[model samples]
Target: MARSLVDLLTTHAAHQPERTAYRYLATGDCDGEVQELSYARLATRSRAVAAWLQERGLAGSRAMLLYPPGPEFISGYLGCLSAGVVAVPGVPPQGRSQNHRALTRMKRLIADSDAKVILGGHEVIAALGRLAEHLPELDGITCVATEDIPDEMAAAWREPDLTADSVAFLQYTSGSTSAPRGVVVTHGNLLDNQRVITERMGHTPDVIAGCGGELFVSWLPVYHDMGLIGPVLNTLYLGVTATLFSPLHFLQRPDRWLTAISRYRPHTSGGPNFAYELALKHAKPALLDSLDLSSWKVAFNGAEPVRAATLRRFTETFAPAGFRGEALYPCYGLAEATLMVTGGTVGVPPVLLEPETGAADAAAVGCGRPGEGVTVVIADPEGPRELPEGEIGEIWVRSASVAKGYWRNTLATRESFRATLPGHEGRFLRTGDLGFLRDGELFVTGRLKDLMVVDGRNHYPQDLELSAETCHPALRPGCTAAFSVDRGIEGERPVLIAELAPEAVGESEKITDLIRAAIGDAHGLSVHDVVLVHPGTIPKTSSGKIQRGASRAAYLDGTLAPVGATAVR
Candidate 1:
């Protein structure tokens, strides 16, 4: 039996040493300069880095991996696994700003994990050196450049003993800094989730053979679970090839993603909802004419709320270019569940649920059913009673892919992961997401934490944000945050922070009133505060999900500056 992922790597290296394992597109486009890594070179380099870590007695300890967008980060991460060190992947600091936001997150992760070693690229290592005076905690940590580790060290590398129960890595969610809860993902969790992904997405050797062998193009950040577990580790698990590029490139030109898809003809590719919208924004006629997406079988949309509008628009927009509507796969998952929990059936169009009383466009899209060996149930958040089908409630999951628990946070681990349903003996993972099952299909509604309650009525923030976006053409779509704030004597009231297009910056007050009136007229709830700021002012997580908690904090701290004029209330 295979002991761990390292065992798989060793096997692949021995059998198909010359097979291309990964290809990094430097310019984001397929025709740009490429950096290729074969199975043999990847194994050798990872072992060399492992030997370096072993020389410093870093086994069984946490090693924080800080590398820019490239193949080196993958090698360093795999090296940690090979060396028996817990890997903590984090964003690396860029630019001369010593206190960059990414750097801040890295510092907090370092402190929380108590990592003893730092594996990074040369530029990142130098940047940390420049900020060593400000961050004294990093001074004692041993820093090594994984790319600089000599090949000679491979001889000294020893494969560490690993098992299914051994901790593989700590996947720290975006909002983890405030609460500091790191999900303790074990080797078993990784392998099980990979199997779940394969089975759910129909990713078999047949698809691989039909698509000309393993090919996946991704611009998602490797630090995030979707990027790490979805594409990076899945490639290693299947011994397939993947093409990677920086998220910066995709954002600069969304068309590059589709172009890469057209050139490589990948069997699987996906991103968040905003990515589809961005692609629609830039899909000009000339660009669309050059694309051929027929080979793309599974186009997944996850890591955020998957909008029915987005799926519809993307399908209609790219249909002429051979993009199939059935290829649009909507899935739901979180880092706590490892990566994927429920994925849509491959080669079938997604199902849509019309709203009970609201507008037709307000309908919720089904995120598909639970994967094989996974049980999903909608439970009343107030108690453990399971709710009937079509009744919205907290999403609970039970599967082998569920992670062990939060690292060193026993209370949080038990509260979130050890939830038991009434009359049921098995524990279920509280997903903290509100959704329901209809005809065995899961439909995600909103986050439980971001729910706004007013006049004894619960309202989802995404619903209000959508209302604000559609109320006026000036308000940017998918860029509004709706949250509730406590008023002490008055009670909790709803607040909306919206981003205005450039031309509408001068008419912020008009747009703000329009949004407030629209919400009141539609939802019957008066908006307490409406702050229309410039575009991109609203905070978002790494995966581009609106951070309502962060936005609330910003509002309370008086940090938001409305463009035209508005009183603080």
Candidate 2:
């Protein structure tokens, strides 16, 4: 019965003062130097920061929290909650790169949230000062490094009058840079979602206490909802310990993720589908020689479309290291629902749904059933008409964990968050995802927005991308973008923008022919254009979800500078 996250922290501090609540891997590896924060120390630091903010009369305003990957971000985030400030977690400037996408995102978030104060670590604070002219919004804001705040301020900390309805933080959804929509998540949404995650993922007290009550190891960025709400906040909610590191670390060396999991033997650890693929790509014999993942009960994958190939490959590749197929927990959710909406039953292997139409080999991974107290229904995209269990339609959800609405955007809020289905009593949140429920299990097909239509036939971008990827070794997998572009009088035609594997840069012409033939054979659709650019050129969200809309825009604007290209008549 924790009233708020602050209450959970206080209770944990009182009961397990000396228990390690968080461990930060400084070098992003298990063998590297580490930093530990006990529950008592976390409580004290958060209170001290809270008192500092209260003294400055910033308790009720939004504080843009920018921090590199570590414990300081957690402290600042919790401090904002304790002080009743709406925390806007954002990415900090990594270096002197002027055109850094993360820094650009920070500037946009600051403007969108109108955050009056900026709280971050020392390095990021200095980086912001250097880029102040570019970000005029920071001119009127009070910026301070929370790590430098003294401990004596804890004495002045005073709890605010908070209730379930009080706004706790703002989760700004990614993939939209021009008009960032911040989801207004209340304290109730936070608590409810945590409960859903705990029950759905089976994060029970026995599971927690058995793993030394320290069972989460995450490299997902702290700014994303999956990273913040899933591992970080849930750690406080469940009173379990979490090991944290930067996403860059995992990217630099995917082996580090497995190494840390092996060393810690945590009960839960996972990321998006791409993470598993990355680990498999780099899983040399030497890298996984000493690995052991028997204690990993939940490998929750979400924040993007889960791939059946990734699940099969990861489990097969690591089976010798004690990884279980049942551990591959494919979940589904968005920031609007806090984090997890549905996760497959614990200890049960994921189910794959074969295509109900063409492409006999096509299949999609089942996301899972709706969590406890969460109701999910499939409805037609055009109307509120509820579809049958196995029919593809827009996913609708009604849950206590749903956020209030999008901040300051009533139109979008109404369209997405406030929706009344035909003959339904209560409003449901339109997830904008195309999926269906079969035999009480949820399986996501593709995005309603990213769906491509050609010659009056429905085509999913993921299926097209997967076809192109498997066609040739020259194409980089999971780095392709497929969309339909308006071709004047011809109506709309399908276009493919794929990243060329380094070795394939010189074979673009040969690879382009292979892509065209493969796509034609698979879907019987002619590719209007095929542009192959260098790796990392294609746009993606922070969590590495391919942004098809952005790629389409780039193509229309002639900004898709491909290293090599071809056009088919």
Candidate 3:
């Protein structure tokens, strides 16, 4: 009777077996161009796909999945889970300058994975072939059909008897280069968190979002946890119609996500901080005027640090669209924890403290409370001891959902999970994030290793970015980054990179000077360098995080800076 992730998913399949469990590539028509799969149907498809693999002598095979957002991707992912195959999700193709690196790294991962077959759609396979031109090793990968998908393949298992500790999937996180690390999560880990999210999302009577109300609407890439699990998995267990869209399609046309919501009347939507910022920048004013966003209930912000100004401006701009101020929900999560760590209470306005920099003591937007069987504690990392609630320290989590650890790296697994928290019975996952608890909720600050020591006082790059963008007329708020210069010298102060208004390109000197003076006077943090780039020039992850490492590398290599940008720095 032990619980397992496969059991958990199958349970949902049993509950409302005929209810629509997943909709891939939804259209705006009355019936919509949706590829609807009921829980029963999905379960059948998953087992059949697994069976197909077994018949082809591919059971327990290692495979890499590379496809854009759609039904085929989901089916492939589930089939891998069902067959106990090692599923390695590929990062979507970045631009030309970055594609080679992505391809090369992907080839290495495939090689390291010993993947027997590469499952992808036609277009993805074609792209893989092109990538092979850059990386010769890619040619050996057996590119095969993921679609024409055996309309009626037999089931893999006649009866389901899944174990809690079986390998479920490999979650990849970006490293400095295009290469990423794969974090192994097990069945127990996925189920524990899925159950937690089901409760956290307020499903007493089964929280449901109809076409226009409380529905799950998202455009984040499925390669990410928030996209695959957040709205997708959460909605399924709750029977809410999860309206899906691809971030790629949205990025190509920013209005689609909002337009879908306005038309579908979906109340629940989530994305990283960058999505909201992009909406403010790229969303047409005419589209904004017509958006019926009053139904928006929970706007879960996570994946990256939440910027206060970005949240504020988003609320203000969307207010005209009937979006309420309280609709903005600032939360925190990571794939290592399955998806959501701490989320704001359902149907309540979120907690918004001062801007990250304004608070000298370093306060964060609270991530609400620990969800089902999950324990969170802030401890002094020098040794395991509880710190005062208001004081900052490392955030440690112990939960049924916390993963076993990185797959092949015993050292990393040993480092990440250990018996530390006094209240918890099991080992904890050191999130590598610094934050604290207040009252009863968790608040995320920043990464432990990334904290910059400027002139003896501790400073965070996020903090500096907040100060740079604050109350600026020309520069949009919360669109800045501060990082210490490792200029091959000691005691190098941090640089300020602010996103300037397109029209204010000529006012670079004044903007930089203003940013420098403000940081120097307010926080006593001197700006060693100042650079102005067009908005969005600084690379961000799919979750909308400022790639500080990437930006720093670009700055050091002299690739990101513009012609006149050198004048100020």
Which digits, one per residue and each the tens of the lDDT, describe model 1 over residues 378-407? 999998799998899999999988999988
What C-alpha lDDT values do all the predictions have? 0.88, 0.88, 0.71
Please report, as a residue range, the 10-residue window in candidate 3 with the lowest summed lDDT: 205-214
Writing each residue's lDDT as its tens digit, candidate 3 over 173-210 gives: 54423545567777777777778876776645533524
Model 1, CA-based lDDT:
0.88
TM-score for every candidate vs. truth? 0.97, 0.97, 0.89
lDDT of predicted model 3: 0.71
Arrange candidates by lDDT, highest first: which order? 1, 2, 3
Where model 1 places Cα greater than 4 Å from the true spot, the runs are 96-99
**What does each candidate score in C-alpha RMSD?**
1.6, 1.7, 3.4
